[model samples]
Target: MVKDVFTNVVANLVTALIFGVSAYIILYIRMSGITQTIRRVIHPKQRVFALHDLKINGINRLEVSKFLSPLSEHERDILVKFHAARNGSNPHNGSSIRLDGISPVSNDKKEYTAHISKVGFFDFIATNLTAYPANAPIRSFRSQMATLMRSFRTFGLIQQVVNEVHKYGEPKKVEDVLENRSLANIISVSVLIVDATGRIGIVERTNKVAVSSGNFGATCAGTVGDVDFDADNPFESCGLREIKEELNLDLERLHFDGIVVPKQKMQPIFLYHASIDQTWEELFPIMEQARDISFETQAFYAVPVEDIIKFASHTRMTDTAAYQVWQYAVKNGQDNNWYKTLLLPFDVKRYLIPWNSQKDGTK
Candidate 1:
């Protein structure tokens, strides 16, 4: 009787083991199929923020949020004002942020002020280092500047001095070292304007004052501004804002070719391409309405899709991703890649552009 009972127990254990193995095999096969199916869903554009290399640090090492230590007092104030305006507060009215020293009250009271090195102030400029390839068009602009200006040559000398200082200066302030680090963590946005006529608006912008200025390969591109952007309408907001800023077009009637976020930190360049029915003469007056218009040196050119890549390549200031996006559009014909395919749904909110439009259609 004891032998019979023991045999029954062993048989039951064997059956359970076989069932568990079969279930696992079925589940694995289903998961593998699901992954491939997701990949097959292609997207038309890439998400720029998804690819950013954001490194979390011990609170002390957070560099992106630090106050602009390198800028002058006036410049710092301007940034603070910009931040305040974007955040719906008065710049002057805000409490003063004191750095370096702290005020000590009696044991009953404690005051806290944000420091210059803290990662939550104004004056931070985001930059993407990888997009600018050596000997690329951007370098050509630098080369031209080097040749044309005596001041740029002096900058080269200053770089040497900075290197020497780095070799000699002992570690003093951890904040100082962080300030000197030039890792650019900027966000890039592109808008493509397509008119009813299929003619796109392209600008030959030599204006360096524009945020992207000398580094970008394309025109009509800028970083996401200080304004709070909603994820639901990011494409419309960024697209329309760029159109109005760069081309002076009212986007109420325009159709946006959804936002394309890049894969690499700066892999997909922004090409806010718009199609407009208006010619240069008709659209010329709108240029004056721009918030920070830089007409110092700009010439309008309307080139077809076939020639845009070449023009952007020659411009030397266009975003590299712009060329790639245009190329993809041309090669793959519209059904290529979009943000949803390249990115997991959770990441979509961060990179999305908020949509905003004027109800009156006036300035």
Candidate 2:
């Protein structure tokens, strides 16, 4: 009897081990492949899954001219109509500024910086999406996972890999969001929020959060999205995403890359310029619908650029990067008084990083 019991126990243990290992392997593959990740996103019981569209391109392929070439006449017409209907004005025709060439590491000596290869930013997801198609988020998804998959975001594979390496270590698994081997470290967009008054929108970060919390900074900011990755003006789409997520407000017109600055070990800040044409009292009700995705904001304030400089003079109340952009826009707007309202037909030449010298002054 004792012998028989020992054999049965061994068999059960082996069966359990096989099942556990096989489950992990399947989960691993599903996480890495875009098509395979559907299982995690479809169920109602699952945690919220953000679908990120990582518009990863190698450094060599990111030619400013190619990305900024004039839109086809039809696309241009569509964009014009789209902006007119939504933004109430036509954006300036001009060159675009990009910080794509900036290095993420502060002291790394490499002349060029691209995504870390191990995580797979270079690998392409076989998605059928083309640059900016006129479509909205897929809301038909009945499940949380479906919602995430349709949310339309792209994450850098390199950052995703470094952040998830530890999850693959042991067989014992607790499912963390990053452990999926898909989600990556984040990049962000900072919009110099403003209104018709030409006032810069600022927010006080909650003291409890990480990084620049409690500091006065751009309240309108977030990661770049999937559609904007390959569009004629992708930066503005990202600006819209941050606005929708934080304030639930989607202003029609936006100017991309009002400023681009790379900080130490940080992705260059893409400061897209957008001015909302509304009063603070009118804005309060609109802001109430906001999801406040990051929970980082304490309050909102709209102050004129000159006032901000004066406030900073005494107390350093400005997000320094955003401050520089205010100066840039003011100067670029010049005698036309366009900067005061952040009107369209924005001057792209003024905003480019000093290294990228593109001379097609008007888009």
Best by lDDT: 2
Query: Ten-residue segment with the worst summed lDDT in candidate 1?
Result: 50-59
TM-score of 1: 0.40
lDDT over C-alpha atoms for residue 299 of model 1: 43
Query: In candidate 2, where is summed lDDT lowest over 10 consecutive residues?
Result: 120-129
lDDT of 2 by residue, 276-320 (tens): 678554676567567873375666666665454432222223233
Candidate 1 residue runs with Cα over 4 Å from true position: 1-184, 210-219, 230-235, 253-274, 277-281, 295-297, 321-325, 328-363
Tell me the spans in candidate 2 whose CA falls farther than 4 Å from its real position.
Answer: 1-186, 225-234, 262-265, 315-322, 325-363
Please, what is the whole-model Cα lDDT of each candidate in the order they appear?
Answer: 0.37, 0.40
Q: What tens digits encode model 1's per-residue C-alpha lDDT throughout 182-248?
A: 2222333565543344434454444343233333333355554334133233323555676576656
